[model samples]
Target: MASGPSDTRVLVVTTGGDAAGEESDVASSLSAHLPGQTVVRSSSTAAEYLRELGPTVDCVVAVGADADVVWTISETDPSIPLVVYGEEVLYTHVDAVIPSTASIDDLVARVQTEVSESRETNHLEEVNAKLTALSRYAKQITGCETVHDVCDRTVEATHDALDFDFCVLAFVEGDQIVPCCSTLPMDAERPIDLGEGVAGRTLETGEPQVVADMQSDPDATFKEREFRSVVSVPVGDRGVLQVVADEADAYDEQDVEFLEILAGYTNEALARLERETALRDERDRFHAFFEALPVPVAYVEAERSGEASVREINAAYERTFPQAADALGEDAADAFPTTGERRLVSDRLRDADPADQQIERSVREAGVEPFTVVLVPLERIGLSASGYLVYVPGTVPSDETRTGYSS
Candidate 1:
């Protein structure tokens, strides 16, 4: 589990014309018990002292101060814990109220407890905010279509969402890890051999590695020697993601966990893109086969209106029916001129298994001879689209078939 801030700062203020001597004694007592904490004694009014150093003070201890001063500090920065060491008062805004008669040990313990609780609460809120931003970045990563796009978005999220000082996204290419994108400038982009550096080891082992002091760690290697700390995580089997800092021991376990979560998102996005690219290549090969066929073929797909339309027509389809060159995007039923032939084609389009329905039509009505029209459902070829391939054999002109298509 991640811990809170290492050091706590407490401000002791005197109000209501009280002497500074009592405040000094209270600060000294608190300092003796608190150890490793700062105790500031201020003789000025609570409001003035708060305005000067409000941001740094984690907790406040008002000595001989009244309820009004307590309210001022609470209203000025309600997040800062406040402890009142004077006459017990019923102030709902104050965190703790200890009477002057109470032992100095009691006051010291109260201040320490309040400061620890405040720091813990602040740390939780910061972590929650970073996780929320990371979730939004995950959505953006899903929208990326290529590996480069995903890597670029990952680097952007590392800087904007994780707030890392430096970051690099590298992919494993053959026996080397190549830099895809980086937050810092790279004078010479070079590849690192697998199992050579921290990132290489991460990619080789398929695990996350965090080095608090890269200079002292034998497994760590730096392209820029200024980076002293590093946290690297594997991006599935494709690559590695690394975040670096200048100061030693800059990152903790929580930082490693956060980077791992981001790397998981990147891995999922890359896998999705790979699947889509393969599907696109398959579709392209099928289209090439459809075009090279010597028979007339028309690709028809269902539109938003639930009507089938001519999405694409092959060269032989245009040569057989020259009028179809301008028929792309037209309704499938419109391809036939006769009412009976149009009805037959439209009925096949609505059938769940159109490939089994074979119909012969006479194109003489459209100034051509009779031929057999074969409806091959696109789903037969592993396509997800609700469409069919209209195949007409022996329809192409042998001497000269104009090679033209509309898509």
Candidate 2:
């Protein structure tokens, strides 16, 4: 069996007749085979001893102990490996049972094997728990709506999820990598060059870089020279996410993998923000053009209720028909409260084609003279939503136009 790590702690519990002698013999045998290992001999019951030592005990060896004691130890701490070294036939819960006739070497080898396997199992459990937490953090990062929010959450995840002390998220701005957010205060004016440091190298190669000992690395270019280890992963082509520590070899391949997962989440959030920003810019441009037109214009949308509603009206439209300002969000039929005028406007908009043709018709609102209105289909322009634009020419003399509509 493998000797395993030297830090293993074995608790030898001796019960029944010859307790002192049994404890001494077991301690000596374990110490002889496993050098630098800790052996604690206890005359107390198995459950009591385990309760006192808690998780500090890696393995327990019971000498001349009964089935009740072995069962109690298993119930107290199932994680602690139990080895019963008595001659009694034990149907109890125990990791291994050695015959009383067995030699000292057999006992030592069994304890070593159990210790090694126990450590491996515990390490795997810890890693799996950390990964589960990182998965939850990734969901929150993806839901972030802005680039700054994404960077903040990314840095927070480094500390909360991965347990890193220092982290920085930097984006490419021109030829320099600008720090967007960091756990430590960073100089915003003096950013890192796109090809200078560990983060720079990650961005350049589009891969993760792990430096076990930055002090000894010739390519290390971070301002904080006190940090001895660093891991940098690229956030797509947009930026790099980096974490550092004061201890050398603080990060392993597992640490790099976790950071890469977080970087991927940040990339998704940034991409979402980019798309939203582009859509907002497009809508702003469209609104500017709508307002700049000299003629009065009103945007109408077909609601789910099978009625056309006036969604928006330009400044010129509001000024020309002052009563129409209150008509915003009202049905088109109510906006033009003239006899048969509602059907006249709705039919023109419904029949308007996508070929960019403007259908002209004369319509009269209550208390206002008849005016020529143009129905232009807005679906072809790809506005944020499908709608129609109502354009009224400025042909009515100022004196002939009414200031308000009559109910």
Most lDDT-accurate candidate: 1
Candidate 2 lDDT, 305-328, residue by residue in tens: 467778888887776665667878
| Top TM-score model | 1
Question: Which sections of candidate 1 miss by over 4 Å?
Answer: 1-6, 16-19, 43-49, 89-92, 185-189, 303-305, 336-354, 364-372, 379-384, 392-407
Evaluate residue 287 in candidate 1 and report its C-alpha lDDT on the 0 to 100 scale: 90
| Model 2 weakest 10-residue run by lDDT | 398-407
> Would you list the C-alpha lDDT of every candidate in the order shown?
0.73, 0.73
After TM-score superposition, what is the CA distance of residue 365 in candidate 2 from its true location, in Å?
A: 7.8
Residue pairs with colliding backbones in model 1 are none
RMSD of each: 6.1, 7.1
TM-score of each: 0.83, 0.74
lDDT of 1 by residue, 1-407 (tens): 11444555677776534456776777788777775565564444666767777767888888877666667777877778888898765644788888888999899888878878877887898899999999999999988978888988999999899899689888888888899998755752468888788877887678888888888888776634777888889989888889888888888888998999999999999999888888789989989998988877778777445666678889887776657677688776776444433444455554555432223343323654544455555543332244545555434332232121211
